[model samples]
Target: MTEISTLIVDGILAVLLVSVIVVCTIVYRRLGTIKSGQAELRALVDQLNTAVVDAQRSVANLKTSATEIEGRLQIEGKKASAIADELGLITEAGNNLADRIERGLSGATAAKKQQAPAETSASKKQQEEILAALREAR
Candidate 1:
C-alpha cells in the first residue's frame, strides 16, 4: 500500500512540472510579441514628432511672406493716392480753361452785334485769330 501511494504522488508531481513548463512557454511568447509592438510604437512617435517640427517651420515662413506682401500693398496704396491727387488738379485746370474759352466766344459775338461796319482789317484779323485759336483748342 505504501509503494502504491508513492507511485501516485510521483505521477502527480510530474504532471505539475509539465503544466508549469507549458505556462512559461506561453508567457515567453506573449512577452516577445509585446516587445515588438513597443518598438513599432516608438518608431511611429518619432515620425509624428518630425512632421510636427516641419509644420511649425512652414507656418513661420508663411507668416513672414504674408507680412512682406502687406508692406508692398501699403506702398502701392500710397502711390495710388498720389496719382489720384494729381488727376484731381488736372481736372480742375481743364474746367477753368473751358470756362475761359466759353466767355471769350460770347464776348466776341456781343462786340460784333454792337459794331458791324466799323470793324477794320485789324478786327477781321483778330476774329480770324480767335476762330483759329478755337479750332486749335478743339
Candidate 2:
C-alpha cells in the first residue's frame, strides 16, 4: 500500500510540471507576438515622420516661389503704370499739336481767300490737291 501511494504522488507531480510547461510556452508565444507588433508600429511611425518632413519642405518651397512671383508682379505693375503715364502725356501733346495745325490751316485758307476773291478754277484745283496731300501726310 505504501508503494502504491508513492506512485500516485509521483504521477500527480509529473502532471503538474507538464501543465506549468504548457502555460509557460503559451505566455512566451504571446510575448513574441507583442514584440513583433511593436517593431511594426515603430516602422510605421518612422515613415509618417518622413512624410511630414517632406511636406514641410514642400510648403517652404512653395512659399518661396510665391514670394518671387509677387515681386515680379509688382515690378511689372510699376512698369505698366509708367507706360500708361507716358502714353497719356504723349496723347495730350498730340492733341495740342493737332489744335495748332488746325488753327494754322484755317488762318492760311482765310488769307488765301482774301488774296484771291476771283480765283481761276485751275488755281482752286491746285489748292484742293495741296489740301488732299496734307491730309494724307497727317
Q: Flag regions of model 2 displaced more than 4 Å.
A: 1-37, 117-138
Score candidate 1 by TM-score against the native: 0.63
In model 1, the worst 10-residue window by lDDT is 129-138
- lDDT (C-alpha, whole model) for all candidates: 0.86, 0.86
Task: Provide TM-scores for the models.
Answer: 0.63, 0.58
Instruction: State the lDDT of candidate 2 residue by residue for 1-138, as single tens digits.
Output: 899999999999999999999999999999999999999999999999999999999999999999999999999999999999999999788767766776776687789889978767786677567656656655
TM-score of 2: 0.58
lDDT of 1 by residue, 59-137 (tens): 9999999999999999999999999999989878876786687578667767886978576778667766776776566
Residue pairs with colliding backbones in model 2 are none
